[model samples]
Target: MKIFRMKNCLLGSAFLLLLLLQFSCKSTYELGRKRAHGISDNRLYNQIVDSSLSYKSLWVKRFSAHYESNGKSQNVKGSIKILKDSIIMVQINAPTGILEVARIYITPDSVKIIDRLKKEYLTSDFFFLSEKLNMNVDFYTLQSILTNSIFQLRDLYERQRPFIRNFKGKAIGDKYVFLSDKAAKVERKLRKDKYSRLYRFNYQRFEIDPSLMKITDVIVREFGEEREMVLKYRDFVKLEEQKFPSELVFKVKDSIQSLSCKLKYNKLEIDEDLKFPFKVSNKFKRIYPD
Candidate 1:
């Protein structure tokens, strides 16, 4: 009788422990969802847009880059700019004693890029340029780049909840072996199932500050690539009622590049009358260069 009672007690304890774990997991999942929903709310996106447009004028640190494709090497030099959306003009002096003048015009429908030195014009819709540059060419990147507030957590992830069904990590020397949901179907779709792509996807593994919600480190692994890219942020400062990063570093395999920008603010005004014309320039013939 005592043996049977002991067995029942052991089974009861095991059952209780399982129930507690299940409840804990459910609670964590709900909390994560709530946090994600809060971040995705339109209020956050609007706030970001509002803060971006508040600055009337700022100085942009322009870099003229020369890349040697075969050698995988790049050389960059600095220039200064006074930007007003109405007349987007920039003067860049390269190390080779070449002064290039460029002008940009942004509208709701199109963007125009003109090179005064080459007398070349490139015009396209925002989406085209964004894809060509492999960047988010929206107000977000522009605002962060201009203000040197590029490293905020809010800026990086936009407060979206990660859809991680199962994640495992193993300590490997100084680094960690990260494995998440490996199912291709689950990985290919966007967070909210808004967009789908063929690119191999994996959950980024890194530590972030809970309070600031800022990403401290990020790792991206493509399905076929043997290595991953890692980005680290440092040296933060407050600029124009916002916090931003002064330095950004990107590393992939054997190549590493660091960009350090100094934010300069000046008393300039924006021409709210700026409009985007739905037209393409002839010089961009090479873009669709026949």
Candidate 2:
């Protein structure tokens, strides 16, 4: 009788263990299935794209800037004007008066910077800027940055812009993370159907705010290097039924040095015909670099 009781007890224990295992597997499977389905639905992406700003022009009355590089910090005030999709003008001035310290003018094909203190001016293109900054960039990316909109990290406008749906987005916590690379399985499927290529989908990650449907952060991964460039946006304010981030931060770090810039927007006006004045003084030497 004792032996029979022992065998029965062991059998009951094993049965309970098997049941627990099955339940765990089923729960995990269900969760994964739901997640996959949600990503497939992709309503979040659509919402995000739709939330991007549509304006003919923008004029920023005042903005504060704080920059930190290698344990040093500085603060200044500035203003920006944008002729939407065409030109951007930025002016950095002294903290007290209207004495301009530096001015930058950017367009679809050109970039010009005037350094008041150094008494020089620089005329360059996006290619040189990319070489110095060590990232793939173009005019569209810069425009997106200033306007707090979503954009891809490559300079493939003439060839083909990236299709955001090529990659997948996953909801984590309160935000959605969209990466710019397709999975092996998805790649195979697309290629099998002769789908258009993803236009050089590099390793990039964009974090979007679910409530505001704006991109809060963008991370770019450099090939053959373990470094990342991060651009973060926050402190959004709504105007005319649209949201814009009033505060934005950019950071880049490597083994040797680190850099950070924080910008605060004080005022914004949209659809205003703005002036972009850029005059190169004769005293300032010209530097057109390749």
1-290 in candidate 1: lDDT tens per residue? Answer: 11111122221221111100000011111111112222332333333334333445444334333322223443433333323333232333434636534444543345455544444555566654333223334533333433322222221332444322243333333232333444335344645573334244434454332233333345554433333445554444344444433344444341232222112222222323333332335643322211
Q: Give TM per candidate.
A: 0.41, 0.73
lDDT of 2 by residue, 70-147 (tens): 676666666777786688777777667388877767778876777776677777775654544445667677676666
Winning candidate number (lDDT): 2
Please count the clashing residue pairs in each candidate, in the order shown.
4, 0
Candidate 2 TM-score versus the reference: 0.73
Off by over 4 Å in 2: 1-42, 155-161, 182-202, 288-290
Residue 5, model 1: lDDT of 17
Clashing pairs in 2: none
